[model samples]
Target: MEKPVHHFSELFEQLGLASDPDSIERFIQRNAPLPETMPLAEAPCWNEGQAEFLKEAVDEDADWAEVVDHLDASMHKAQ
Candidate 1:
């Protein structure tokens, strides 16, 4: 069986944390280097749709305050 190579971005996504390059770089520098390979079950899965959504949201020129307000309302409803 082949081992898996993980990027810092994948690790943060799996841990439900921020996946920005700076954050990932800091995490990798602070922690021990990860193995070049791992079991498939332990590997992280990438989602293209999620990435696209994020890009679209970030690229929008509209006021983010309204977006934040909607998100907060949605979260409150979810709870």
Candidate 2:
């Protein structure tokens, strides 16, 4: 499925960041491309179950805070 494109305001709201163009640009520049290598020694592996869970999470129509919280909890549990 094609990912829906969002405005900067949407991204800022989702991230709980300031909805300013400069701030958004800085964030984009700082974290646009994630590194291919794992940053930690014991990074969580992405299996089929996790992938399905994430796909469901992303595709759900829910509040941004709830979605972020769910993702954070999942990552924390995986660690």
Q: Estimate each model's TM-score.
A: 0.29, 0.37
Per residue, candidate 2 scores C-alpha lDDT tens digits across 1-79 of 7456555466456445666878755654544333344321123433455444444544674343344333334334322
User: Among all windows of ten consecutive residues in candidate 2, which has the lowest summed lDDT?
Assistant: 34-43
Reference-based TM-score, model 2? 0.37
- Cα lDDT for residue 30, candidate 1: 45
Looking at model 1, residue 31 earns an lDDT score of 37
Over the stretch 1-79, how does candidate 1's per-residue lDDT look in tens digits? 5435445455457446578988755644543232334322222332565433333443662233244233223323311
Q: For each of the candidates, give the backbone clash count.
A: 3, 0
lDDT of each: 0.41, 0.45
In candidate 1, what residue range of length 10 has the lowest lDDT sum? 70-79
